[model samples]
Target: MRRLGSALLAVSMFAGCGGLETEPSPESLTSPSFESQQAPITTTDVDVAPECKGIITFVNTATFQTLDAYLPSNVVTNLVNRRATAPFTSLADVSSVSLVGETRLKQLEQGARARGAINSTCVGIFDGLALSTSDAAAIVSLVNTIDDSELHDVLPDAWNGAANLLNLRPFTSAQAISNVAGIGEVSFRNIRNAATLSRPFEALAAAVNAIPSNGSAGVQLKRHFDWWNEVTAQHGYSQGGPTCFGLEPSSVPYGATIRPYLANSAEVMAEVQSTLDYVDADTKISPNVIAAGMANLSARTQGRSFKGCIFSYADDPWSRHNVAIFVDTVNGFSVFSETWWAE
Candidate 1:
């Protein structure tokens, strides 16, 4: 079993005895443009004491609207009121606010760190990466589930220690990898780096795995759409309003620069139409309504360019009814469409 390269087309059917399916022709589905579209990632070194001056500053100085994006409104209100009378002096002081638990504290810390507010060191090898909780979780999942061969492929330099990782199955945390024999700091760093680079494919696989093998097309499509929203939201992508006629906006970060690649709107819509035709073979939804919905989606995003791919699951008989559209806009937001029909 070779690694599914950048344009991973490996399909996993949800039916009995799942096996890899053949790649669809390029004309049908656009592969992810990870290799070309990925930008250079820069990280800062944080070698300091336990004091989290950055987190304290962010909580005290950031505006309420900015704070609201990273925290619950109630927690934000409590933090604001608490900080107003007396600014938080330490992480403990921030935690003392009502509704601020360990998890919430981590969220705040990560959010602050992402905004360059945290200059001090934190726990975990992934701390400096400023990863969202979801991205960290995704990396953790990749490490726990990836086999030795795949691990070696991703971290060729760490191949000698790959066996140690496989033997120590089900790593409870990303940090737990450090405990493995032969997995030194460099190996751990490489593994985490690889995991981060592979997040897009991991996200796609996770979304596909979420769909039920035996369900109405409507149900499965909705499942994939929901999973996409949840995962993207965890990565700081904002969601727009609910789906309008099986078409909804994809989650994308505010003020993000949209880089159009892989395919244009016309190509994406064609692939989408092809997927809908496959679904219509067995679904009760009329072709006319599907066309109208697609037209609406087109009209909504007209003249706007996108850079992403459409994953069509029409190869596997059981999963053929599902399709995933992941496209990005100039605003650094991803737009998604959820095509559905009543069963």
Candidate 2:
């Protein structure tokens, strides 16, 4: 197999390009041309623990609620105040659409898709490309897991090797949450440098949204191949190899033994409490449920940050397929809330 440096150089030379115009860092590639509206999805009902009955009330969180708490809603109206913002790239294909006055936009999406290829980490990248209603339904059918059509999988590959995405790439859930402060900058930089490609923000957004919330670290690594070309084009160098080829590979987070919990309400409470206790006692990091929710929203808003926390649900409220809550991809961390909720 080709090494990373060799592969990248080979890919770049074959494409007849040494490098496209250097663009701003991923931090500067913030902001999409369109504005996204936030709507709340119905939450699944879970029994509340008596110990925390009133403390954990229902908070209606819409798609919009997950922003960095810095961007204004009416971005279009306040063009001057509107900062660059990466729009959420849902898992749908729109390459064949023919909306009035949107021909160029459709071409843009298609070009972005072709330019920003897929990888092992984002094997589902094509699934996230925004498309017409027919295409959306088709992609939804392929997901085959969740019932909700809107909840497309956020595969981890979205935030990997591309040099421009370095700022957006996250190593941990906490880092993902903290990166929101600079999303606008990333969005701007991506758009400014689109001449090298077409629409970096759109392409990157599609990659980010295609990440699945559940999968092994290997699945995550596989998706990394999809974007190899984009990485070479962006960095002005050729490189290739398995996504996580050289980096010392590690197990997904929370992929180990699970703690047992009773099915009763009080048991559920104890279970959740225990999970938090485990996070605190063992890793020195307690579960920050609210903060996690916000981080997910922020990641969606910026269309970047691919780190997520996956909790295992079999026994421990935080049980993952294993332990350490391995990130399926690079998007925002998943809280794996089912493990903590009342059964």
Candidate 3:
């Protein structure tokens, strides 16, 4: 694909499948059910001023060309010919391209529609880039402009309520938006099928990009945890000593960033269930004991984030899965066990 110079539309093609090399986790088996995903996106021709953050529909990838400084002219030529990348169906496909990266990728993918129209005149979606989460209202307002749109039904009231209350962060993929608010299964399916969602992000995409990743979350956790080095040093759990020391909680900064990409909260809720699983096998506890265990440890947070709390409590863990066990935060009297959600 690279030999043909296909870097024009959001960078070189990464694969025949949607962009990211990683496949949807085992949970994504459900994607096919709502998979009536159209090949070409659908859009209305309301001529929007670039200042309005209008959606630019690129009906055909095979003939699209742009000379703006995004990609080499030669690469754009290759994409126009389909000699390099396959027809881009969604941002998921373009996002996988190696060179596009998140910033430019968001701009191009959000600005241009796929397999739909031949729009050459619309907002220069990628003109300037900035990140922030306060744009959801404006973005939603822009989406509302899509006359006779179905988005209102798809996202629903409660989900929007969750968005407003939590000040839900901006998100890139339908997969990621599924993360924050209490957007449940039915809504998620409708969204995954909302193919045009790739383009009409308006200001939403910018804010989503601004939100931090798990990697950054991990970094902050470790930084705040510098205060706990004293506690870890005395218990033989010193940084890099035996267990969680110097384990780089920062490496998992995206822990909180897990919502959209997580696709669902069962993974988040699993944090609690995992503790139960471990307790079930590791200890011969009953329903009564399990209830008491949670009742006792639930208040131990001391206002710390779930994962890095100096103290860890396992209501009951079947075994460790994604969560990590360590004295990196704090170990309580070497009690039952210390467990926290690992992003």
Model 1 misplacement above 4 A: 1-136, 179-277, 280-343
| C-alpha positional error of residue 105 in candidate 2 after TM-score superposition, expressed in Å | 2.8
Q: What is the lDDT of candidate 2?
A: 0.22
Number of clashing pairs per prediction, in order: 5, 82, 30
Best by TM-score: 1
User: Could you say which candidate leads in lDDT?
Assistant: 1
RMSD of each: 22.1, 23.3, 19.6
Residue 262 in candidate 3 has what lDDT? 13
Inter-residue clash pairs, candidate 1: 250-336, 252-333, 256-332, 258-330, 261-307
Give the alpha carbon lDDT tens digit for every residue of 1-343 in model 2: 1111100101101111112123222222112311011111101111111111111110001112211122233321231112112111111111122221223323333333233321111111121122222222322232232111111123222222222234343323222322344323233222111111112222322333344433322111111121222222232111111122111123211122222221222322233334434323223322353234333333333332222222232333433322111112232112222212222
TM-score between model 3 and native: 0.24
Q: Kindly indicate the candidate among 1 and 3 with the higher TM-score.
A: 1
Model 1: lDDT equals 0.44
Poorly placed runs, candidate 3 (over 4 Å): 1-62, 65-75, 82-85, 88-107, 110-274, 277-343
TM-score on alpha carbons, each prediction: 0.30, 0.19, 0.24
lDDT of 3 by residue, 1-343 (tens): 0000011222212233212224222233213431222123222111122222211123122233331244555444443444234545433344344444445544453434232121222222221211112122223333333211133323443446334323544444333444445565444333332322223221222222233444412111110112233223333222223222222334232111221111112322244445445334224334454454343233222232222222222223422112332221221111112233333
Name the runs in model 2 displaced over 4 angstroms.
1-94, 98-103, 106-161, 167-273, 277-325, 329-343
